[model samples]
Target: MGGASNDSSSSTTRCGVFELSIFVAAIVSGTACSICSKTMMELHGVGIDGTMELFTKPIFQTFGMFVGMMFGLIMHWAVLVLKIPFPGYEHTSALDNDQRPGYNTTSTNYGAIQSEKDQLLASQASTASTSNATPVWMYFFLIIPSIFDLGATALCMMGLRYLDVSIYQLLRGSGIIFVALMKQHVLGDRLFFFQWLGVFWNVVSVILVGATAILNSNDDVDLDPNDAFWGVALVMAGAFVQALQFVFEEKVMSMEDAAAPPLLLIGMEGFWGTLLCLVVVYPLAYYFPGEDHGSYEDPFNTYEMFMNSNTIQWSFVIYFFTIFAYNLFAVLVTFMLNSIWHAILDNFRPITVWLTDLMIFYVITETGDFGEPWTKFSVVQLLGMFVLLYGTAIYNAPNAGSLKLEGQWYSFGFNLRGEYEEIELEIHEEELNREWEERQQNFKARRTSSLAERSPHTSIHTQALRGFASPKI
Candidate 1:
């Protein structure tokens, strides 16, 4: 037993260490990706003296990201083809054998019961029809997520042009609000009181962050309030779109027959995204006039700039590699740990990006040439950051013990029917009644056995005493 316990503890420790190392890699890669992307847009060429920002093409940046995703797909295939022993390498079964849990018919409402039954039947039917091999037609469902990804990435890149990296990162917290709302309506996931509270705090954090960005605009950095407002709007809109993508991906992946491996799904999305950018997004960017006639996105000009600039070309390469690494690490983190851990990692990413931005601006390039400089410190921004982190922590907290909050209050649900809880209560009451009856029966049996063991005279006398005590009843 001692040896077994020791082995278990040792295994857990090693696992923890490995996960920690992966998390660190994820942070580094993610931070590097963000900084590289921002630098590509902001950094000037070595000899070019004009104010021409060569990499101001948000559409091209989006295209590069999809290309990176394609590379990720290739890498995934390579691992499979080589039979490499990678974590999360095994694909999920295309069909699930286990049926969905049934609702408590005694306590549940007719409507909810019927709905659950219908869903269960549908799932069973699908699973029964599905073969071991994933259907080719199901792969096309990935296009939906890919389209959402395109919108989200393009909008964010466009917004990144107007905002600081820190602000851009901070504003992303708003996505949780959209996700929460979508989960409730689209996925039928009900939020507990604490989660709802967390959502509220997240909203407050976003508002604070946005206000700080607008009010504390740095004149030295040529920060405009109007531009900042537009940036916040764009980033928030992108976050909303990204939230939709997340919810849709979850919904699709949860399906019994349609589920695909994470890497394959990402790869498919990338493939579709790249094709869409080339055929649709790029063409639209070329023909349609933007804010300043290609100032925002001109595919032809982007091509020219890419051809002429070595720095731009190298930045794109770095961006591609970093994006791939970040996605790979992210998927690993999610597979090894839980969604809560992934969320925590995401919360940490902004801090890493913010600190790296400060280092680059203040220590590495004191002239604001390589990256945007940190604006004058604001107590509000600092407070908002803390609040944002706190809100995120609250949302992802595994239990009330983790936050030292009242568990009952935190877990309070607003479901009017309370069907599930009622079922549980009924079961508990039945168990208690059964145990009480068993105890009474045992007591009577013990008394009867004691009487039987007594002598006949003693038994008669005891019966006579019981009869006298019963008063002729």
Candidate 2:
């Protein structure tokens, strides 16, 4: 009776207090996390002109993200459609004993899932292999995410036009905050207090970033017509859609073919994303393009819409290679961080995007073209970035212990323990029982009278008999 009543009260408290906040937060956070991939990729989309201010180029990074997409449309279109190249091989690697995994938590599947993610991330990070194949049907899965991606990309471009690259990047970094929020609400994830603190700090950093942009606006160049309205609107849209993808990707990561590998998925996504864009945008853009598509001379030109490069053009070739390389880069790095993480598709092409933009701007000036000088970054803005970095570190505290994994060669998930997954929630019955039995044995092994009396079956093993049990996210 006491247990039942307690359960009832707990349920009421949970329902009455946490639901709404979690949902709202998840929607916002998910969008931010999803853009991590997009942002990295964005660097490859738009090429920079020496005449433009690096910070001033609104969507330069975004233009870079889809470089391959642009190239595919212009260069690889015919070859891709016909399926001419067929390697017909699935590369396999022997796992070192170090690569073995274990399940050590209430969420029995967590360790395994993470292990798989690590493997996938490794493939994504390195560019040794090449493929000319794709699962064509994958295009169908893209509609939902692509709609959201395009919407978000549009918004990112708009925001850039009104703001500088540094400011826009800082703002975009807030997507992680949104991720935390989504985890709480949409995913019903419980957050540690420190994680919340990290989220708060990150938010403050974004505000600082915005302030920096506004302050830096003292000297300005010409604004394209309707750029602000459209850019801002698209940015907001991107944020919203990014949140959507964060949740969706997490939910899908554990499914059959999904958990199978990460690099393959990244490759397929780029391939299909490029294909879909080509199919939808090409005809409307090239042959019967909307007035918005602009002219042929503008292919690799604008950071806002499409590139000015073409199939046979040198700039066009460079653009595609850059995009592909960075997409691979971003996918690999972020995968190392978290599979639940997003693929923003921006920030992938360049190291210091704003810096590059500025260099380009100055070169354009040296050529006798008028280029603007950028004197920005207030003290407050600098501090804000520092705070943001701090917040990111704090928020990642749960996984901070794994920090050594960064940039380490042997650290490529060589050792796995307590593995689990996001979408594929079922735990094997034997596995669960084994865990329970192990816990009981551990308790007995400890032989602490007081601890043993507290209920020996309390570990995940107690839940073993329950079929299809999923680990907590």
Regions more than 4 Å wrong, model 1? 1-24, 45-54, 91-131, 218-221, 291-296, 332-344, 399-402, 407-473
Question: Residue-wise lDDT of candidate 2 within 1-473, one digit each (tens)?
Answer: 00111111111111112222332333333333333323333333334343321222223333444445333333233423353321111221111111101111121111223355445534642222222123345445644544554456646755655554455555666667666676666666565555566677777876775655555554345544345444434454565666665544444332322221233434445555555555564333345432323432233345432333232234334544554544333433232222123322221211144444455457744752222235655566567767776666545432322122222463344222212121112224435665786576555434522212223333232233121112213
Whole-model lDDT values for every prediction: 0.61, 0.40
Instruction: Give, for candidate 1, the lowest lDDT window spanning 10 residues.
Output: 100-109
Clashing pairs counted in every model: 0, 82
**Candidate 1, 1-473: lDDT as tens digits:** 00111111111111245667788998999899889988888754332223355467688888988888877677667755664434534321112222211100011111222344345644654454344344688678789989998999999998888877877877876777887676666555555555566677778878888887787665445577888899999999998997777666544443443445456667888899999999999888777767534434666566666767888889899999898787667655544443234445555677888888888878898676765454465556667788777776555444222232343454344332343333335445645664685466445434432212212222222221111111000
Error of 1 at 457 (Å): 70
